[model samples]
Target chain A: MENTITSIFDMNIKPEYLFIHLDAVDNMDAIKQMAVNLAKQGVVKNSFIPAVLERERIFSTGLQFDETGIAIPHTDTQHINSSAISIAILKKPVTFQAMGMPDSKVNVEIIFMLAIKTAHGHIKFLQTLMNQLQNKVILHNLINSTSKKLLINNFKSLFNKEN
Target chain B: MKKILVACGAGVCTSTAVLNKLKSILDDRGFKGKYELSQCKVAEVPAKSSGYDLCIATTTVSEVKCPFIMGIPFLTGRGLDDVIKKILKELEK
Candidate 1:
């Protein structure tokens, strides 16, 4: 069995989980695709997909930034096996109900699907990611990165500076 | 000290982000040591809200005993000043 102690500290974002120029029909399609991929990677349980979909419906994750929009979709900790952040740069923007305002809509070009295994364990990473998201230059670079490798490099660099 | 509750869908991601941002904002605005922030799932708001002086959530919540503020501004950096003013106003009351 994988050492539980080591696994708990190994929640770094995996490159395989990063998707660039990903093609999806809509918000649900994007989330389902990412959730399914995370499940295959053993980062989340098979039940994560349905739970995330249901959660997204009730509490939308669409955040509209100054220059672009992004969505962070996630579910309960019970559906996750380990902690990971799966990022998708959509080939085309998809409509998602705005966070805290279901009546409004946002065309999200980036998706950050969070598979958190514990309640408060990943707060530092989450805070850093939020601060990065608030930076227009970083958000632009993330959306325009031509390749998955480039995107992951840029993404990792953002966190590297913080730590 | 004022008790502020920050909540999101799962209480893990967005709420954590909002809580940290809120804390820094409060600290910068000289609200240090004046309040305590707690994170929880949106589903747990109604039950946990009464103990708080304010409830800020990334999603819609109902039946909250304290004043409710939408925390999406903290994530998007839009209207954050207004939200902070609102939070300070609530904390003052």
Candidate 2:
């Protein structure tokens, strides 16, 4: 079994998990709902929800770049049956109890749901993730990207550079 | 001089993003001072922000006080200017 979460670029669209909408609830909840919907699709497993919640409870996974906050949700390996990721873009901002600064709230705009199958994968996956976060140019292109294929390609280029 | 401490889940990824933006903004805006950049887990954040003028987190952290700003926007420079202004305004005091 592969012990790492696939990079956003390596992930193929499940089609069912891909959703674009103007969320009505608190933006945070809207993003969580996206994970839940994906869970129900048998994309991962039922345990994924609590795992996500647990991770959230431990610390906020809000990806802060610029004033834009991207909420990326993931759980321990024990919680997942498969490895996948979901991305949800909110039409408006919602207040979230941000990490590090509980007193400050995060006005979340983009949320990426990460589903990991194992803890070992977690480390490797995060390593790539961290590298990607360093380059604002790539990040800008990612946020500016519209099509999923473009998104994936942009991400894969990182690995290509590793060769 | 504004004292800022920026941290992310691993300290390198998100926190670095936060620091780069801040350095750019502060430089462009002509503000300078001592700043600290490091990576840490959420559990360590509470005890970490001390003697620091401001705290920047890309993940959830609590049990610490001072001005806390999330680095989410800094990742893409999406809604960063206003937030940088907000933090700078407070630190300028």
Candidate 3:
């Protein structure tokens, strides 16, 4: 289990992958900008933008936390070249359809755009992420952290703690 | 063993997370040997849900044959006790 977690939690989140206070008026715009940034970083294919958008339209990754609203937008492995997670802190919260309840809306401030290369390969990492999000203090720190370096360090520490 | 189906959007990411959490919960409740778990995508639920005793999914689905439980609480840590109670009750029946 430890080995599996060590391998699965190998997130390629760098300082460059972290965006702070991005100016996106809507959910699509937020995903597009993040996907484009990930593509430029050579983490995902160029087709990732559209595919992520379509998946968001259908599945709707919007999650409502007790303290704030966050979204985890991801698509199939076909649209990705590698596995990477990009973090974007929007300047203004954008409206997103809540997960499991499409009729409900969540105004999201932070977006975790996941670019995965395969299905069923990163279970440990994904579980750790979900468990981490449940902590209000961690989410609060993530959203309030202003420095990109600090954010990267904070995320790395969180992932590291799981393994 | 009782078969339980768990599903999410891509059938890979969120569903697996739910699966692990459910496994531990069931194990803690002394249900480790009594239950079996399966994971799939939401699109496959309508087709595959018939074989399972219960379907626990993170995403909303159309019509499923068996009793369905929402698995979001497993992730968000909100109302998780109630969700687990529902699962246990369904398994008991």
* lDDT leader: 1
Clashing pairs in 3: none
Off by over 4 Å in 1: A1-10
Candidate ordering by DockQ (highest first): 1, 3, 2
Docking verdict class for candidate 3: medium
lDDT of 2 by residue, A36-63 (tens): 8877867767776766666676656654
lDDT string, candidate 3, B1-93, tens digits: 889999999886788889999999999999979999988899999999999999999899888989999988887888999999999999898
Regions of candidate 2 where Cα sits further than 4 Å from its true position: A1-16, A21-24, B1-93
DockQ (Cα-based) for each candidate:
0.82, 0.15, 0.75
Better of 2 and 3 by lDDT: 3
lDDT per prediction? 0.87, 0.61, 0.86
TM-score of candidate 1 versus the correct structure, residues matched by position: 0.93
- What local lDDT does model 2 show for residue B9? 56
Candidate number of the best TM-score: 3
- Restricting to chain A, the TM-score for each candidate equals 0.92, 0.73, 0.92
Which model, 1 or 3, shows the larger DockQ? 1
